[model samples]
Target: MNIAIISPGPFSVPPVNGSSVEHDIDEVTKMIDPEHQVTIYTRKCATYPKSSVEENREFIRYAYKGPTPYLQKIIKHIRKHKPDVILVENRPTYVLALKRHFPKIPVFVNMHSHVYGSTAMISKAKMKKVVRLASGFITNSEFLRRHFMRTNHIPGHKIHAVHLGVDVSPYQEAKLHSSIKKLRKQIGLKEDHRILFYAGRLMRGKGVHVLLKAFRHVSEKDPLARLVIVGGTGYGSNRLNPYVKELKRLSEPLGNKVKFVNFVPSVKMPLYYQLGDIVATPSVWKEAFCRVNLEAMASGKPVISTPRGGIKEVVTHQGSGFIIPPKEWSKELPIIWELLWSAPHIRTEMGKQALMRAKQFSWYATAQGYLKVFENAVAKREAGKQPLQKTG
Candidate 1:
């Protein structure tokens, strides 16, 4: 089978500094069976060349920066070597275009956010056209799958929920004493400091503000606790925006109790994960799926997140981590932080369980799930059967 993947057109593959969706594309391609010739498409970046291959996969990057040119590049390539099935990441409109260009080919549009499924980004009439044309819809989590169905009036059978994965080996490597010591010295942290980590877009919707608000009480209660917030407003974004500026102002009273690490390359994230004694992902809005949970869990650190979207599905509350409701973070955050901070043994045991849980969600598993979907969609199309009819 020849599998062709289209990136959202902004991020480069190998996920040098892109979103988790790109990272998913990279890892899933690497783990996909060697028998299939996987072809990846993404916008070109200085960090990566025009074309490259890793194992059984091949990358054909476009120098064009935006969506239209990116689609043209993909169309040109597909005309040359058409795929068995087409998978477009995080772009619902691309589904309509691909289906229009090659009506016979099966195209699956992946949904990574509520914004994409809702009428906010795409009109209802256009979404109906997408539903009528698309072979299938893929979501990062079952919660997202269900939410999309409700919002878009999509039938359950037309969509599949394939959870994102974490490559645990890299995070496990960060646990080495030498690596830990090196990172500790680099970050100017003492051995006794209880590092609390938060990574994702530094926006209000991501709940960074909520984390900062809760951390004020946490900092006053625990002197040894240090909060380290990671990421910028967007991918490779450096300049602090208003939200980040507010975060800075909020942290002023806490002084050095809080540290903000602006967006670093996706590859170097594990080192920051290693520095955390505990991880916080308190998303105020519905998160389709947050890969940071898996990354933190793989780092052998217990996660502290809210029960928003697919988060509760990923984190085993009190066993692997704590999933307090967003409403209760004000009271629960400090207590949970105190509990984990007071007992190293509790942290160790939960961390072990967390690592065990993380192992189940490997890239290999994610690849297998996607491969099955692609094969089925392709097989169904090849049989000369009509595409799935629009369901509401």
Candidate 2:
């Protein structure tokens, strides 16, 4: 089968660090059956050229001079390729356009988060229309699937929950001691220090401030504990962003115990995970799914995250790690951190369980799940069944 995947205009396929949605698209496309042809339509960034073919898949990029013109380029390519199915990611407006222009073609809309959130690039009304028009909907987690169904008034059957995948090999517990020692020495971390790792955007809603507050309490209890923040404002920015400045100000009294490493490349992320004794994601807002948590778990480290969105689905409380409720992070996080800090044996056992759980979610399995959804949508379209419409 021939497939065409449409990505958001801001990033390219196989993103460097962030861009989870783009990363998922790239992984699914690459890992899918080689017999099936896949082409990804994304913006032409400095790293990716206009057209490149590799790993039995193709990437076609467009320069975003303007929305209308760029979309026109996309439509032209879609017409030329004439794919069997179309997969659109996170761009509801473009989904609407694709469905309108190619009414007979099956277009699957992949929702990475709530359509009404601040990160949504399209309007609610347009998103509703896209939901009604698209052949099917795909979400990264059951939490998002339920949220979309409730908010958009769409039926549960029309949406599928396919968890995102991670490459767990790099994160495996091999050369653990050597990697830890090397990273600790390079980063000027002491051997006795307990590192709390947080890797992602330094945004307020991500609950970096909450992590700081919790870390302060933990530091007071365990003088050897340290917080290492690894990220920038967002994708592509490696400097001290406004949020980083705020975090730095919040950690002022804590001194060098709170270390900030700006924007590590995705390839080098496993090293940071190896350096961490525990991974903490104290996001106040709902995370559709966090890849950081999975990466940390795959590295044989227990994660301490909030029970927000689909996070609970990933981090099993008292098993892989503790899921502290967002409201009680100030009191609960430090307690959990202290417990895990005191008992290295418990951490080791949980880390093993975390690695085992991480194995269940692989890019290969994720691609196969997506393939099943795509095939079903295409079959429905061929049988003259209109896309599921939103019911009143």
- Which candidate leads in lDDT? 1
TM-score of each: 0.94, 0.93
Q: Which ranges in model 1 have alpha carbons more than 4 Å from their true place?
A: 177-179, 385-392
RMSD of each: 3.9, 4.2
Clash statistics: count for each candidate: 0, 0
Compose the digit string of candidate 2's lDDT tens values, residues 1-392: 88989887777777855677787888778789988899888888787677999967998989977667778899998887799899888766777678777888888888888743222566677667777888888889999999888877778888999998888888774436466687777777998888999999889878999999888888888889999998888776876768778888999999989888888878778877877888999899889998889998999889999989999889999999888877788798778877786787998999999998898899998899899998887776667755667999
Q: For residues 53-92, what per-residue lDDT tens digits would candidate 1 score against the true structure?
A: 8878889989765677779878988988978889988889
Tell me how candidate 1 scores on lDDT.
0.85
The TM-score obtained by model 2 is 0.93
